[model samples]
Target chain A: MTHHAPTNIPTTGPDDLVVRGAHVLDPSSGLDGVMDVRISGGRIAEVSENLKGLRNIEADGLHLFPGFVDVHAHWRTPGREDEETIETGSAAAAAGGFTSVVMMPNTDPVIDRPVVVSGLVRRVEGESRVRAYVSAALHEGLKGERLTEMRLMKEAGAFCVSDDGLGTQSSGVLRNAMLYAKDSGMPVILHCEDHTLATGVVHDGAAAALAGLPGSPGSAEDVATATALVLAAETGAKVHVTHVSTALSAALVGFFKGSVPAADVTADTTPHHLTLIDELVQSLEGMYRVNPPLRPEGDRLGVGEALRDGILDFVATDHAPHASEEKYLPLEEAAPGFLGHETAFSALFTELVLGGSLTLSRLVGAMSSAPGRWVGDGAGRIEAGAPADLALVDLSEEWTVRADGLLSLSGNSPYLGRNLKGRVVGTMVGGELVQDRTGARFGSRA
Target chain B: MPARNLLTLEGTSRADLREVLDLARDYASGTVDRPLAGKIVCLAFFEASTRTAVSFELAARRAGADVISLSERGSSIQKGEGLIDTIVTLDSLGADAIVLRHPAAGAARLAALHTEAAVINAGDGRGQHPTQALLDLHALSGHLGGFDELEGRKVAVVGDVVHSRVARSIIPAFRAAGMELAIVAPQTLLPLDAGAWGLPVLPSVDDAVDWGADVLYALRLQKERMTGGSPRVPSVPEYARFYGVARRHLAGGAVVMHPGPVNRGVEVAGDVVLDASSLIPDQVASGVAVRSAVLALSMDVARSRVAA
Candidate 1:
């Protein structure tokens, strides 16, 4: 986990965007050897080294892999576009080696029905170079009482349904949807903050009491996650926990590890929750402000252990964006999410990879394979038939997180000026070059 | 020869200062209970005051009243509203009483002429913080077993008195009670008219304590007013060497007092403030009692007029 100064290797040329593999490591397909991945039509057209002079990029001291998939995020869309938008958010996704993302449906026009669902899909398709999937809310505007037209929303192409920012207050409606979702083969993603119990932001503990700051109590996350697990167990439906920030959520994941049938539960934890502690908040100024506020030092280190042990599933960018002016608004009034896409790989490498709490195998698996499997994605593996959506990275490179050096449009990032030990050198979305490390330019490889 | 000390006050009387402390005494006992049910203590601090602001606000509320701490900052004052206009605005708000802290001496008295509501001086430009002086007296009387009487005691006033409103009001109380007084400070920090009161003004803390004064009242080190004065007191270490009170300064069973939010190791040693004779914390506690008394007495007088 030692990082010397990185070699100033030149970035990829326009003609040869990806290198022929020197050593390719794809944990999803259990493939680890020299392999070549090719580009055409913005989708994986071929995966052979001898597939005719197809832009032979140099692969010396580099690792090529699939672009990541993030299934849960509050883009702060429609309503609070100052925090994040479809174009800026997709650029964030692509910068972190994410080719596609499942956008949370808690915006101005809460995606509860097919019309709102189709609107977001069209917005992303129209404005973004990346594919964006919308998760329709469980109830109308996520009020948690009346259910929206679930079958109609699925027909309109929502991958799942979730009350992302808050838990469904009505258990009966949530149960009904889970059963219906089980029948339709669609999962229900839940945010897991029981409204009646959640009083404020930040983890409520002795530390919060001393500081006179309000606490986002653990019982709220515990009760919501437990409730969701029981509904998932009873209905035998697939459920995914979004932004799992508490220790009890990790504990509940362990508690329900093998207890139910037809219960395919996966969770994604964010980068901010992993590295930053409450003490760090005292120093990081205010950029560390986020939902389920930052955890205490114990919870911060506990998440690292959870990632290493594989109790937690993937380390998601949850890659939320916010404006500088909006973020500077005092603690109570500031936006809830922070930018993570540009800093995701570098931060993950610095913490899990360089810090020695997580392995390269699990990092790739969680970031790529696990998200792909939960959403029925074709990438996360570099096998013969898998799509050529890829992320070529320099494992030996040590770089500091610079705001001016990101491909994402938004300048708000929590890891601004943080020194990290790894970075994404190249990114291919469906065989098309979406991001290149040289000149840090973004274009299609097709 | 130690110089004789004199204190200049706007109202000029030893008897009047005793009346203030006597009223402060009744309030300190919590015996004078009146909610001032419909009364308002308008705290008009034109500048910053943390302790004074909070103490006055709490005093009004604890007696079953309400308080509206009008912040002078970011108000119409910034819009060129003069002091007279601000006073009129406060009067219109139906303030039962106004506590005024201004940068000019006599501003509180001027403010009183402008409004029918009673104006309590919360300290006007270092002119006279008479309430703080009365509370200091009340604290000394209670701690030293001299309640309702100060006929023959000795007090040593040390530290800055040249520009302190607190010193201006406190000296008369000791003088009117037929007690001995000692003004001890450096030449620059000493009042210019020290020889007029016919008492001793020793030049150092050790010299004052050696005269067996029954109480030592330490003035806050007034750095804010120490401009254009040469031969100023030395550095903190040198100040402590020449004037800062220590355990050695308690030459007898004398009590120690300070008007606080004290600067540690500057005007007084940290441990000295925590010593056996220090009534500093008790002085802060007495502030609430003194204010409640002021509010009640002022309200009663106002009420009698309405009844008449």
Candidate 2:
């Protein structure tokens, strides 16, 4: 399999610097202590108690971890630049301590052909602040009818293929696409939903009944997930299910994992799914509207347990952004999504880690190493010979999320007005400072 | 009562219901007072409505308030004006109350966010029609003698309860008014886990009559429910056979009610609609008075008058 490295253009080459005296934690490498990490040629050269370099950053009392990798996000470039551009989206990811994000290809003129894939890669290289990988659409225009050229798309720099905004209705169509993706060595990211059952805007529950809104049953997600898993077992294709909101879907993934050991299936649940429930939809606010809609408390707890038990593999911020006009309407007419890139870690930290449902190390693994391994980059580790993708966080600091304070162009986050305990102070991609909130500079380069 | 907007009737108190019903009774008795003389009421209907819109307009005019009407067709709303923009415009025009009928659920709540005006939800998609519930209660209470006499009275909400905004509002409001409620609909036409509402699910209209129901509140059988791409009911005849309240069902001294623009023979027998026991006409007549009470209460005009 040919590895397509995530594309990004750093302003300066090969920083010779040291991140000093920070509580370095890399769960994958089993290093959890205060250490100085040295970087040379944009790669971590050493991690020790005391390391000195020409340029040093004093990161005392802060926590440093490998940068997060978001396997699912919508940058909304090329089509809805008004909602989010690649530059702003990457900056938001950097602020959220995400070093690498795979962009979903449901843009205006959907990214199905090799030309579109190559064009997006070039745009990411030129405009993005952090590494951004392109995932070409599995179906042309995401219509789920005709398969795109997956092998050619991978050759043109696509790391995966997805038709994220919509689900493939036909099992035959999805199976054919999976076969093509398997041959092309591209992982298939499935957003599973039976469209007929998902006709309602919110999760079908007591909240929907009370609010009198139309509801989509969890069977919608479960049925589609079962189909995808069965086909994955049959086709021997690598399938990564994004935004597994319902408990049954996660259980389906777990069931398939044991039944078909060689199926090669992984699943992710979003931070919103981990913490929020369908009760929020009772307010009828559009910001709470999302695809695979926020489920009941039982489903929320079940999905969280799945992630904690490793039945669900990682955390991916399906960071979909929409303009205010699109989001601030009535629930039925509003666009379905939340601005996820900026709040992924803080939300998880406040809700999961601090709440004792998940340990910080496990959270780090899910956000960083697990997804990074899936991305096939060998990136998300603070070790020698690995890319210096890192985040400096002030874990003790308490900050409230505000729309005006978010780096993303759209202020559609459900976390708006939430007080979180941890905040990303600084972020580095390949030893270059992509985000700096330290308010102090240690030294200048020679 | 602390909330300015009457978005839903789910959490409404008996005292609040009494206040509205009493005022509506007085208005029906030809009470003369202009509590809303200085107020401006804006009627914004993004969906088509005949009874709700006309009655709200008549209610506001009868209370001597200045009225402004906006409909989806032949208006700036038709030109792609958002609900928020229209709400802001109404608020900016010094509207003291905005009666809204929108085609999306939660529209009244969303509109309440953008404006200071008290939003009265006439009907919002498949969501609540709070005022309709209020007027229904008023009509029923009048027929039953008084609100105090409504206690332990059994009413069966029959047919298409899932898609009916009327059912959504009436279920809670009627329950809060001390009426014991049961639902009579096909399994396909019921909400998810309908039994979770703590109400009995009677199988047929005959069973509802056998269960000693005092009232048979039938909801309109929407045309789409029977003829749409995926039919909820097999046919109109099949729906009427089991769920419709026929004239024979009224032998047990049960009255029939429907929120209208009703299909005459679908949810209720055509002859049964004009039966002496049918309160359908009274439900419509109660609209203007009950809406007047609601508008006055929402604007705090009635509250101020009581305080004075």
Q: Judged by lDDT, which candidate is best?
A: 2
Scanning candidate 2 chain A in windows of ten residues, the lowest lDDT window is A437-446
DockQ-based class of model 1: incorrect
- Candidate 2 stretches greater than 4 Å from native: A1-3, A7-15, A441-446, B1-4, B33-35, B303-308
Estimate the TM-score for candidate 1: 0.60
Q: List the residue pairs that clash in candidate 2.
A: none
Write the residue-wise lDDT of candidate 1 on B1-308 in tens digits: 11111112334466655555566666566655654667776877876788888888887887767677766677776565656667788989987788777654445655676676777778765456767876777777778666445657888888876556676667765666556788888765643334534568787777877787777888888554333324456577777776677887775777778887676776677888978789898888888877776666566632342233
User: What is candidate 1's lDDT per residue for A1-446, written digit by digit as tens?
Assistant: 11110111112223333446546777887767676655544444456664434456656577776678777666777887766677777766777788667888888878888887767766766676455677888888788888878777877777788887767877788899788777665778888887666654445553343222344567777788888888777777888877787777887876676566456677778887887776544221336567777877777777767766767878777666667755553343356677777777778878777778778877888888877777665747766555566787887888777777765556668777878877787766655556676642232222
DockQ, 0 to 1 scale, candidate 2: 0.62
Root mean square deviation (Cα) for candidate 1: 19.4
**Any residue pairs clashing in model 1, and if so which?**
A19-A57, A42-A430, A43-A430, A44-A388, A65-A391, A202-A216, A432-A445, A433-A445, B4-B194
Among all candidates shown, the one with the greatest DockQ: 2
Candidate 2: give its CA RMSD in angstroms: 2.1
lDDT of each: 0.68, 0.89
Candidate 1 interface RMSD to the true structure: 23.1
lDDT of 2 at A24: 91
